[model samples]
Target chain A: MSESEYAIEVENLNIYYGNNHVIKSINLKIPQKTVFAIMGPSGCGKSTMLRSFNRLLDLNKNVRVNGSVHLFGRDIYTGDMDSVEVRREVGMVFQYPNPFPHLSIYNNIALGLKMNKLVKSDKELDERIEWALKKAGLWEEVKHRLNDYPSGLSGGQRQRLVIARVIAMKPKVIMMDEPTANIDPVGSKKIEDLIFELKKDYTIVLVTHNPAQAARVSDYVAFIYLGELVEAGETGKIFTAPESKLTEKYLTGKLV
Target chain B: MYQFDMRRIKEYSFLGVISLLSFFMIFPLFHIIFTVFVDGIGTLVSTGPVFITGTLDDGGIGPAILGTLILSFFASLIGIPIAFAVGVYAYEYPYSVIGKATTALLEITQEFPTILVGLFVTQILVLPMGTYSAIAGAFALAIILMPYVAVYTKEAMSQIPFSFREAAFSLGVTKVKTVFLIIAPIAKRGILTGLLISVAKVAGETAPLLFTAGGLYQTYPDSLTQPVGAIPLLIYTLVQSPSPADHAMAWGASLVLLLIFLAAFIPLRLSIKEVRM
Candidate 1:
């Protein structure tokens, strides 16, 4: 594969929170326009590693990063490159559905666009918001109530709204950290289908604790435990054959 | 059976002592409000509207009311911006050395005696200008007002969960934009409550105005540099006079001051009870 085929190239990545070594040395090559899954048990440093992709880990005072994460061949954590600019290119959806509650639905979608000057005029902004919402499978449900707050929406709808917020930026890579963990079963199913639809246009890096969900959605899978990658390969190959005892144990529900 | 009965007796005694102490604590406030209304209402009725509109000769407190308003407004204008900036900085970088020092200084200043502030302003402003002025009084009040607004702002921002901060930053917004536009707006109700409560506090202050405000009740404040009389300062001066009429005037002024305080405080108190100290 060509070097340009990778959406994100994390090299010798290590993260620390004060005295604790959270993410030990690791390297990952996530392909463009595919659903790449990182699965681990809870508190296994999976979430901490995802945050470093967009420099969100920089918000924590105790965290220290010691490697480079390249986005489309541009090293994001190095000199002359801006983290704000990096965030615009890499959008993330958290475990919880967090839309800006104080803003109206219309404004929630428009905030990043307006703040970053992504769109030109009022008409352009409205068009982009409508487009993003439609892409996220939320436009029909919320079209009539665009001026309302997100507090009135259901958990699944709010999560889709968050997805719309990220999509409005037209980012190259989208990171989802257990996006459906808090939603109802029906809501989770809808998001799973939406994720399948989204992978055609954007690279989706999903973090999940459930192996079955990873098998159902992701094209490639990596199992991490105790801050180390135990195994990584195509989703089909990893599920069928055993590469490492740790990977087999984790898949069999014996490693957690 | 005996243990249950003993527990019931202990509970009743705790309730009884708590209610008794609470009533004792609130008794003085009620007694003071009752006395002020009884003595002050007559002065207000007999004097009519002039009681609020006229000068000392006309037996009105218009100048003092105007003075108090000017002082509070300007003090807020001077203090709120500085205090708000300090508070947000303290909230944003709380673990840093400067941030910790700022929080400690704010707490210390809150407990510092108000009289010393008055004396400091008197030396720096009044003595240099060669007269007691409203500006000097407002400056002193602004110093006292800073700690209240800054501490409240810090508390309000800290009350927000860390998740919101992450959500805002993840949107690619700069830290400045995230702090001022996003985070601050979410904390607006608490910040506004702080502004109103501090204004109410400074409006009722008398000791800070002793040497700063020269006590002018004869006329309305024509300029910021001129001497002025506040309702609290007027009451303080009237109570010391040997005249019976002055004592009546003091009671009426006290009533006016109390009303001002309630007008600002009650609605805010109703809207946000948790802002209470």
Candidate 2:
């Protein structure tokens, strides 16, 4: 893809929790409408950088940022920028299936749309809810009991509903933070398939501790270690012929 | 076989000890409620005024009951939001120094005596107003209950897996919206149970009200500034009075208090029930 196709541009991005600098200076460009994966060892800054894209780290009051993260070239961390808008444009899913317990699956999906005022009428809202649920591959399972609480669903179903909630927002970018880490192998494969299907329109940034998952779904791969970016290239090139020893070590399971 | 017989005796003795301990723990509670019901049921049914009229004594408890309810309602109304806000701040914004300090203070508040809470409110609120009243009592009770609400709300909010917050945040929901719309709803039952427990705590309190609420039986107070009566105070006075009718009234009030406690406890218990489905 050309430079014009880039959906996110990072320039000298650095993150800190308290006085300790976590994510070292980093720069990268994520192509539009493709799956980009961030892989790193535990406690590495891979998750931190992913969080910075949408400012999830800001939830921790002690966290401080020292670099620029531009969502489609607009500075995401600027005072004039709305964090909510940044999040809506760049949605997120976590490792665990965390469907809102009090909300029904239908309401869970509808909530995002309602909060953003995306749909005006009840019929339109219902349609949007169904559309999102279908996109997440959860419509059939939850259709009969749209009013049932999300707690009634199985773990995989709950995770899908969470995804549906994100999809309902119609974001430009969907960031999945270890989306399959908490599920069984079968459930993880289902999520992998969903991610492949979702990348047609939305730019996806997936963070995974699992290198295999990154190889499976991502078009481009970025490897991070000890709060520093080790390599960024085409996924095939990064996995099979990594120029960086760190990246090679990671792919081979020699380094955690 | 002889050695095994000795071990069996030890095991039986241990079992006996546990059973006796459980009875020791339960006996007083069972005695208190049973005695109240058996002794007070007769007086409760006989006194037309006890059931129909508000008060049981010369002052009557009607105004006191109303005062207690009104005061408690206001206290809960005021404390619930404040405690909830504090809870959210403490757990949700875990990294903030202010949030940390507030949480620590709330933790300390949990150990504070109700009397001290009353004294503090009296110094700050009741004394400034120049008279004891229901509002003062409510303020005291609210202070007493704020820690409970905060502690439970913090626990409830904290119990939510980090994944939930991450998911909501990634979806572009504002922190405030995420909490109110997502976290608060999920933690509703736990929060409800906590608030109910706080209500039970405030309902049973006598020391705080003794000074702030003035322990007066107002036939009817026009406003919160007027003195009010509560079940605890009625029980206190009834227990102390030489008259048998007064003693009977106290037992009836105790039974009523027990019923209210059970009223709140039953739903709490059901919420915890293992649904077969």
Candidate 3:
């Protein structure tokens, strides 16, 4: 497949926070419908890089970007593309489960659909919500409590609710920034299982500091250190036979 | 043993001193409440429902109570929307020039003497309208009410974690929708409490209505454009009169005003334990 077939293509993406350079010259290509994990140590700019993909960095005035990020052959950094639309197409699940606390579980899923006017009637909204929840593997457990607030749910359940919320938007690309970092072991395993199931339809970009998670889940793994990309390739090859010294150190117990 | 005994004595005496001082600090408040309840309740009881519902001739501050309610309600209606917008603007762009200026202005206005606000409104609204209208009084009170609500709004909006903000934005809604639709609802409790507290504060203010609401006491207020009398302004007038009868009425009105303030303030303060006034 050609480069246009990729879900996201980044070229020489350089980012700065005021005067401090955060993401140095980096190039990446994320294939469609694949679990592309960007793994790095804490504070190594993986989160920042993930934020840049959907122009989330625009929310902060201090951050500046000087690179082209093309999402499926369209240059998202170009002057005319609406950033809000870009974000709608690219959904994000945070490290912490943040499903709008004020909203009920059903409204949490319906909020995006309502905002975007993606669903027409109440019945359609209900169907879409049920569909998204089922896809997130949380429908049966939460179907009875759809009217309840997210604060009543566990951390892992909240994360799944957030995922369902994002899924309700029907985003083409879904990004997870350490989605299971704050969850319990059981919850984390369920999320990993959900991730394995979700990659069939949407492009998944997983950010993790854990090499074990990357090895277990990701089809493609990119190793980043400080502000630069150390190496990126098939997860198996990178884990078993890393060409770069930094990649090997990161995969082994030495780097962290 | 002597030194150790001296240390214990020192700590005990220090506690006793602070406890005494604290009691003294709270004594004036208790004394005021006691005096008002003692002096006012008799008049309220003797006069029956007339003290609340009848005119000054009928031994009631009925018009002033009505006027206070009207002025406060109108002031909140006028102030809350503008205050909320300014607050959200300041919270969204704390570093921008207008946002910084808005925050500073809110602070300065909060510290401002309310009498000056009344005088300014009197010059612009009262003098021009050629009468002391309820609108003018409400406008004056709204000026006083703005900074309280605005400051509270900004603080409340800022208190929501950054992650929620990120999550809202990630949903691809416009910044306006994200702030107003999503974030504003979450901060609604804080904003509501602030508005009510401001209402209580403005309801009991004498200076702001001194000139703006031109002391109506004979009958119930029928027009927003006509001269109005609030409970505080009426109490101020009654306290200065030579009549002993007026003194009793003043105390009764003061007690009513105190009750109004406490009614709005106490429950709100208790509901949000983390927020400090």
| Tens-digit per-residue lDDT, A1-256, candidate 1 | 2347799988989999998998988899999999999999999899999999999998989999998898888888987358899899899998988887778899988989988999999999999999999999999999999999888899999999999999999999999999999999999999999999999999999999999999999999888888888788899999999699888888999986
**CA displacement after TM-score superposition, residue A125 of candidate 3 (Å):** 1.5
Maximum-lDDT candidate: 3
Q: DockQ winner among the candidates?
A: 3
Ranking by DockQ: 3, 2, 1
- Scored against the true structure, residue B139 in model 1 reaches a CA lDDT of 95
Off by over 4 Å in 3: A1-3, B1-27, B265-277
Ranking by TM-score: 1, 3, 2
For candidate 3, the per-residue lDDT at A64 reads 96
lDDT of 2 by residue, A77-183 (tens): 88746888888888888777777766776777887788778899999999888999999999988889999987687777777888888888898999888888888
Tens-place lDDT digits, model 3, residues B1-277: 4456888899999999999999999999999999988998888888899888999988898998899999999999999899988998899999999999999999999999999999999999999999999999999999999899999998978888888888888897788898987777788777777777778889889898989998899988889999999999999999999999999989999888887778768887777643211
- Highest TM-score model number: 1
Categorize the docking of model 2: acceptable
True-structure Cα RMSD, model 3: 2.9
Per-residue CA lDDT of model 2 for B111-153, tens digit only, reads 8888887888788877888988888889889888899998888
Better of 2 and 3 by TM-score: 3
lDDT tens per residue, model 3, A155-212? 9999999999999999999999999999999999999999999999999999999989
Better of 1 and 2 by lDDT: 1
